[model samples]
Target: MDQFTNFTRKVSANLTPFAEKVGTNFSQLRQIATEKMSNSAIITELPREYVETENRFEPVKHIHADLVRLARKYALDEGNVDFNKLQNQFIEITSSIGEKITNLASQNPQQQNTQNQTQNAYKPLNVTIQHQLASACISNSEIVGASLYKFGSTYEKIGDFRVKMNHDILENCINLLQGEFTSNIELAQKSRKDVQGARLALDALKSSLKGASSSKQAATAIEIEKAEEVFIIAVQDSMKHMKFVLGSPIIIESLRNFAAAQLEYFKESQSLLETLVTELEEIKLTQDALYYSEVDHH
Candidate 1:
């Protein structure tokens, strides 16, 4: 995140001057378009600032000088001019700007963005097409604001179509991020449920084993057998619930690995019980000592 912040800062710094120059050019064009003159479109034949014109057509001169200034400023800022790439594009845009402004003076308010275009009035398909394109462009993973504007037409009412486009893209990005967040949350809930079930099963199993180990002098063998049977049934019930909770492939694999290790410990405990019973069955102390010695050696 810190790295991303640093990268954005550097980008913003580099774009600042470029943004300023573009703004200046935009203002100059707006001023020229809005100017009112007696016999011509320009108010002052010669710009008060620039004074290099001789006997050339004055408005044409301003337009020429403005274009040169724009080209020079752009070149200085960029450090290189790619005429092969940008010259034709420049001519096309300048011509479009001239036509748009000319139409605006004739009461056809410049239809800057698609949304603000009035000629397509009463056309529902146009509206639908505009909205769908906007949605897809904004939601697209590959495009950002500038790319959308460079490749697509935008509206004046849509206002800095780049900004609106970015906002829409951001909304889609939020929805995508939220989906990941929700998936993680669900996984965490499942993990917690599995852990709780396993814990309860383990506790019940421990308690039952403790009860079996704590049996002392009791009634008949059948009664003792019934007591152990009851404990085993209770333990089996707990294990069934644990298995249900761990039925998922991921959980089952983990349980299989864990149970493999734990089953040995229970077997060792059973072996210890068998050894004690074997010692108890011996009638003589010598016999008990011999059996104990053999079991310890084994």
Candidate 2:
């Protein structure tokens, strides 16, 4: 873990300062640093964790759902917006996000308890799918960024390296995505077991809480309380397995780099779009001036 952390620190030390010099905002880069750099397993496990575990889940789910709804609202609020393009992009991005959420929610204790053996058997597959999803998200960001770069740069030879870099990043993401898809099938088989185990633990805790509240039986309450505590600890341990597999700092660092690169691409893209809009406005003004001038001369 220390070695991984050092590697991440070193990678950041090298890339971030240079990226800032090249014009990347250091602060608006949280998504890159936390989400991208964290192990793919952590990213995969987080959405699941926040969704599955009742004690730690409700607030997180509410926040996530709200974010999703807000994003949809923004897309729809534009009355003049191109509905097809806007909605399609929104759906693709959001749906992928939703899938991640689903995976998290599926980790109920009831499901996990029923499939313990199967879950243990399919660890490898789960790992693969998770890596794929994490890699794809990064790669997709690069692809979008590269397209923007190409459009923004007007295909100039000087921007060739940037374009090529984008392609390389895209390729890397694609490979990871493919691996994830392959692993996803195996992971599914164990999903039930994972969720069931978690649910059972939560159920036990709930029953204990009720016993403490209803009966004046201190001993029974203590026993239930201890059971609940034990259950929570067990759940935490299980989640760690899923989380650490991907939460490795090395993966996190790589994701950070990918995110940083994409942000650059996005900024460049926005600039290009603005330039195009400005040029069109100028052309319209020039045409209007020519028409008025000719009429006056006549």
Candidate 3:
């Protein structure tokens, strides 16, 4: 009986604070509801500081959300050529061709040795046009086929550079923007919620103050003063956090990194394509001469 009495006492001690908290919350809710429904209940006006902070926070919130969305869109891997996949496909095609060549040359030991040597010396091409033209070159269409192979090789390098550019943008720009949103913007949003809750509680207490009896009015006034201080502090914290996010240099740095990656990619691509275009013009001259010579013979 003594042990049971002690346990009961311990439980009651634990529940006492919880019960008081529940009662306080219920009173605040009742006051808020009464203020909303009863025309006789006085509605407290929010502080000007809080109202101004909230107004500034609203636009910042939308801007942060928009930036995060744009970051995700920019980081999307779709439409970008995958260099690894292209290389793998190139390997598969070359391996198949090598096997067939080896099989056909198997009847003659000398020819088989030559085929093996050719296969060992072959460089794998990633582009489809390169593979097709290389095969045509092997079949004796030398000029056009060799020129196309050179063009395709450079094109493959451009594809690799494009993939690298995409990765750099993701790592340097998109990731940093997302990190800022999570660390600063999200924290500011949470603080804003705290401010809103503190405002509601402060307003509820103020509305209930008018109904307090003379004997309890002094205590109610003290509670309202404490609530006001809490509301003010909450608003200050929220505003500070919002300002940090709004003024962050990370966003500007991220934009710069994104632009830099794109610029590098385009510049390199343009340089490579320009060189290939010049080479193609030379190849066209050779091709025209070969065509005219063949036409004269026919």
What candidate 3 gets wrong by more than 4 Å, as runs, is 1-53, 79-144, 292-298
| Top of the candidates by lDDT | 3
Q: Every model's Cα RMSD, please?
A: 48.9, 28.6, 8.0
lDDT digits (tens) for residues 81-155 of candidate 1: 233423343343344545655664565222433333443363222122333454345334144433443223332
Tell me which of candidates 2 and 3 scores higher on TM-score.
Answer: 3
Per-residue error (Å), model 2, residue 213:
40
Model 2 agreement with the true structure over 1-298: per-residue lDDT tens digits: 9999999999999998798545423322332354455563112122346345443433432443454344333323333223344434334333454553465368764453344335336422211222333334433434554333223323221122233234333333323333443244234324434544444433433433453645545765665566456555555655554443333343334345456655665676567557756765676687779889999999
- Per-model CA lDDT versus the true structure: 0.39, 0.43, 0.68
**Tens-digit lDDT track of model 3 for 175-249:** 787775658878988998787677667777776677788898899889889988998888788888877776778
The better candidate by TM-score, 1 or 3, is 3
Error of 1 at 157 (Å): 3.0
Could you tally the backbone clashes for each prediction? 3, 25, 0
Worst 10 residues of 2 by lDDT: 123-132
Q: Candidate 2 regions off by >4 Å?
A: 1-240, 249-258
